[model samples]
Target: MARFDQAEGLRRMLAGPKPRVFTFLSALKEDEKSGMLVNLGVTLARQGNQVTMVDARASEDSIGAWLNASNDQTLLDVAQQQRTMKEAIKIVAAGLSVTMLTRNADCMAKLPPEGARQLSRVFDVVAHRSDLVIVDSEINLEAGFPLASLDDSELVIQVSADPDMIKAAYGLIKRVSNRLGRRGYGILVSGASEKEARLIYTNMAQAAGRYLAVPLHYVGNVPDDEHLRKAAHLGRSVIDAFPKARASLAFSRLAEQLAMSARTTLGIEGVPELGVGLGI
Candidate 1:
């Protein structure tokens, strides 16, 4: 029997669009990133999308802890030929798998040619198996942003309504636009109501467009819900623990919009059907 070529399949999948990597850049706190990622991951999974979260943040603010996960193997292991991507993946929640990038955190930011190529291959394998791969990126002194990853994946800038945070967020956009040239980016406002979130996005978007010539897409926001806190304290996704909460609903809507938008823009022409199980 002729065997299927997994490597060729991954190459083709990367060439197409159904499966996408979305690297999130944020000036928010660690807890905020972890919370938002958990909510977003669970929400997308509930909506029948397989999700793989790359915890590339520093070890101190690791997303693994948020999901009660401890990584014995990480992407660094893959980089060093110690483990395969499959071995590195830790199933945290239903339909959510996480791979930590603890050792290669700095390299991910700097992304030397060899580092970038190896990391890209790791991401490609994960992307081929999942519908959406969310990379929680970290800031670096050398490389500034994860250029190698950000260059290829859809970029989303996460911010809150705090004045300092808003300023920092804009600064991040400016730096990226200057370095990467003008590009469209998605903005996700956390800790704000729908009205407030829109207002925040509008303010940032206007500034980005006027000054940097970078287009910002409002991907939606998570409201300030007590249920969110409760879910976090209980070590579960808000969507799973508080399905009717404002934050949960907001995440669900965002996931739906993103899925639709990606499919439309990327043109899921020849991709295999992702029979994602609705697991929340």
Candidate 2:
């Protein structure tokens, strides 16, 4: 991969299109989800988009750990007045900023009014600074989506080829549609070939359309590439460690598509408009 000029990339993203935050809700295990988010974030950052990743997981496994970033402070620290969002963010590969929110007493509690306000403030600060945000969110449609993950942002539900994983993904989509109302959802399949991934999406999409009257959008997939595993073991993104690998190529394409989708969703031909407010 060619080296990207960070200054030039920021300028391009700022002048060309409005920024976007994509929240991915996945039923995959903690490690899998964390790895995927790291790959996506680094790929987007390398492609010249200023990306920030928010790790909102309840699991011990962390995206920050995968990126080899120190988690001295988190979003909770910002909420509790221990640190600022700017202060909490750890800069990682290709200038990707990450803030990890591990499971804690406060993280498990219902959102308090004051906490919500602090989080909103953090959201505003983060939104202003970055060209793209990838929210590695917890899978909990049972309580509706998080406020930071909502409003004018794309929602993606990551799925795998396993029967149990497909069932969980469908159930999540059904609950989210019921709670949040009918909306578009991007289905990103992992651990499968293009042909297999298409089949999985086709089956799930058909079921969602028939049973729930919901439309599922396919956001593409990553093949079961061995290089991804090796890169993960080395604490580096496949794009960085093995740029010619199959998974690296897939992630590059996915990042390009996501940027195009953001431009298409929010028209940015003229001056950029402010994004919707954070609602919990």
Model 2 Cα lDDT, one tens digit per residue, 1-280: 1233455446444653333777788878879988988898889989998888876654467676666545558766776788776778888756588876634434636677557656756765786688887877754536454553343356788899999999998988887878666656778888887777778888988998898888777777888889999998997889999999888988888888777666564422121211111110
Candidate 1 weakest ten by summed lDDT: 268-277
User: In model 2, what lDDT does residue 32 have?
Assistant: 92
Give the best candidate by lDDT.
Answer: 2
Model 1 misplacement above 4 A: 1-19, 68-72, 104-112, 266-280
- What's the TM-score of every candidate structure? 0.82, 0.82
In candidate 1, the residue pairs with backbone N, CA or C atoms under 3 Å apart (3 or more residues apart, or in different chains) clash, namely none
Score candidate 2 by TM-score against the native.
Answer: 0.82
lDDT of 1 by residue, 1-280 (tens): 1133455446655764332777788879877887788778888887888888887764656577666545658776687688877788888666788887655455454555565567667766777888888888855654355435445567778898899999988888787777667767777888887677778888987898888888787777777789989988897888889888877777877788667655555522121121111222
- How far is 220's C-alpha from truth in model 1 (Å)? 0.9
Runs of candidate 2 with Cα error greater than 4 angstroms are: 1-19, 68-72, 101-105, 108-111, 148-152, 266-280
CA lDDT for candidate 2: 0.72
